[model samples]
Target: MFRARSRTGATFLALAALVVSACSSGSSTSSASSPAAQAAELAALPEATPSALAPYYGQKLRWRSCGVPGFECTTLRAPLDYARTDAGDVRLAVARKKATGPGKRLGSLLVNPGGPGGSAIGYLQSYAGIGYPAQVRARYDMVAVDPRGVARSEPVECLDGRKMDAYTLTDVTPDDQREVDGLVDAYKGFAEGCGADAPELLRHVSTVDAARDMDILRAALGDRKLTYVGASYGTFLGATYAGLYPKRVGRLVLDGAMDPTLPARRLNLEQTAGFETAFKAFAKDCVRQAGCPLGGRGTRPEQAGRNLKAFFDKLDAKPLPTGDADGRRLTESLAATGVIAAMYDEAAWQQLREALTAAMKKNDGAGLLVLSDGYYEREADGRYSNLMYANAAVNCLDLPPAFGTPEDVRKSLPTFEKASPVFGEALAWAALNCAYWPVAATGEPHRIEARGAAPIVVVGTTRDPATPYRWAQSLSRQLSSGRLLTYDGDGHTAYGRGSECIDRTINTYLVRGTPPTDGKRCS
Candidate 1:
């Protein structure tokens, strides 16, 4: 089953790590600097040398009109490896819808809806480029550039569609030695596949490198400074950019901020707990409705959690038939994945109910399999998206593996299980995939400290699943001039997802530079 990263404000904030005592531990009491001091610090850094940047600058782009009306398409050339600029070039697909209407134009407004793997050009074409408030679109060109190692930017693909289908169905929550070995072999095969298919590119797709690429895109677009709205993992990208070029930041909004200071293990564990929190909320709501699967059967949510575990155990004993011609089957891993997928958008809850009801009652697993396929980005023809492959490549490179071995995972299991008694074991096992990664992490945990930036709006949902809400609080505290906007609700991102308050608040900031006051709450 494909793991769809949680999208609620709280989940995205969880990426920032909980702002608890453990995460907020002691740092050197370096004298706190004023905003002006921070700006000066940013100014003091050595300028990027033209000689060092020549390869990125020298490459030409072929601009042309595109699929969307009034939008243009172009491909910018960047070093395949930023450190080895002269080695080669990579093509980055870029798109822009020029500003329209009756106001003086602002510079380009870059938008990336966080996947570390999401297609930025697609995000622009589908949502931000066209659906952003007309007022903001009129004053700023809605721009999107596909980050390296992502869609339209020479994506990293591992397994073909058919192989991936088999892989995703493998049970992550093993019930015996054989299932466990299958899971391990699956991880090894996936890592080996990525190494063979895209060796050079895989090694160079770090977030730092991606941030540098954004700078060049900024320069090439004729924007002296960058204006951006980055959600989910996009928050990490924006934070890294601000760290690298603080003085160049202009009107940045990092919704669903990722805490840069946690190691992979902590991040994954917290996220597991977050999913549990979201699940409980869903369960509570489910009880009030008729035909509720987990509730309304004289079963409390905790008992419901137990029942779900039992169902997984049964599936592990004998994988159920999915009724597909390929003879695909539903295993514990796929079931967990389907459950996780529904967490992304609460709108999918009804679908989740129908899927779960079918699986729990009939042993027919097609519904759950379909949900898993969507999250995995499986094509009807059996071609798989590079999303999961790129997701692991980027994630593995961004930070160190959560565990060193299966034993280390075993040692950490209790803590993870405590965090999310329901989903902990499965997520903990999933997090272990990186333990066998082929490459070492290129970056480490550290504060981004985007000090010289203008008022940057950081939004966090109170109960976000992927990025926990505390992450938003931590990021807001870390940024020199961050204004916190709270979405007291569920789902992945709050903006443009049917929240008028969130949409207007963000739109107001984007168009007028009037950031919502810190601690403002929107339902």
Candidate 2:
């Protein structure tokens, strides 16, 4: 299934497995510096970022009234390939809802709720612009700029709706050689479509480039430094920004933070295990309810997982009708994606239980189809958004493919299986998507030492599924002035997801320029 780099109000963060060690490894990462030292380092950097990037920083943004009330939209232009400025420019879409003030203005609070593909502007308009706490909203302007190749920013589309439907139904957990070949062919086809659709742009959507674009946006907005809250994959983006322009980092909140050092394989494995953790939590709660689909009463969570696996197997042998009108059936891959999508947010657990009951007991796959469709941004009208396409484009370009081929995946099977016995096989195969990527990778796994930045708050949900808690810990330790904010909870992200304590702590940092105590714990 097309992995949905989900929207704002949603994501995945895992509870990272700790690697205990006693001694310092080397010299690259040292101890934290005081705020004064950090600021001095930041200011000591050149006023002009680089001789090559002068045009980008000097470019102007012409904002005009557009879309919803109290908001303004603007078009930002940046070099399509920073190295080849003579080649052309890429247009970026930006939107901002100025603060409704009772409190003094606090420049801007740029918000990105994850997804290399998630629409930042959409998040600002639908959620952050209005849903944020009034006191914070009253001061900081809620701003979002769609990263290059995202929604409203010349998005990259791979497969059409019909082709995407088939791709999603393609069996990922191949049982035989034929199924394995089919899966490989599907991956090849997807990569080919993406290349054909945006051959030039596809190669340029790497996270590092996107970080550079954010810096240009910062200058265009007339903000000397950037203040941002980035969740899930957005954490990686923000961290990249800090790494690129530590001197320009004002206050960054990396919630559901990603560890920049880990390679793709480990990240996938950890995230798979995170899904299992979330599933167990869902299972424990499901058993207490009446008519629990997987199990009831004293049923163990492992048994529930097995029951779900059995259902997936059945769907694999014979796809269930979803009455999708488009004639799409609920296949094993899509169902797994849907089930895992709910694992990102506990709030969706009840609906997940109901959907499971319908699929497992009532023989209706419609509920599961709805969930899968939502994940892929497939509308009822048989149209699709560019979420999945940009997701792969950016993911594939940011690093080398997770697997080189089906054989490589087979070799990694045991580790993935260990990561999540229930969902491991599909996830292992899912990582193979980038194996057939058309564009060569532009970035690599590296530590983001945002050394000279301000005291950035790193929030880690205890049981986050996409970005693990340990990642937050790792990131906090990496930044020179990073402070850790712990949320003892399950879910992808922490801030504004129902914790008054986290809200207050982060709000204090954003509104008052005060950093929360390092290693501060909040439930």
Best by TM-score: 2
TM-score of each: 0.90, 0.92
lDDT, candidate 1, 1-523, per-residue tens: 1122322111111111211101211121122422222322211234564686775765556679987787899998888876677778878889998888779999899988776676788778977877888888989988999788877889988778777776776666666778677777888887898888888888888878788888889888888898999887888788778878888888888887666765566667666777788887778777678877675855677877777778877887888888876777887777777777787778988898888888988788889888776766677777876666667777778766666566665766787778877777776667656656687777666676676778888888888777778778877877777888999898666777778898899988888888999888999
Which candidate has the top score in lDDT? 2
Give the clashing residue pairs of candidate 2, or none: 12-466, 13-464, 13-465, 13-466, 13-467, 14-464, 14-465, 14-467, 14-468
Q: lDDT score, residue 374, model 2?
A: 79
C-alpha lDDT of residue 132 in model 1: 81
Task: Give candidates' CA RMSD values in order.
Answer: 5.2, 5.8
* Deviation from native of the Cα of residue 174 in model 1, angstroms: 2.1
Clashes of 1: 19
Give the per-residue lDDT digits (tens) of candidate 2, residues 15-60: 1111100001111221242222232111123546677778888998
Q: Considering summed lDDT, which 10 consecutive residues are worst modelled in model 1?
A: 12-21
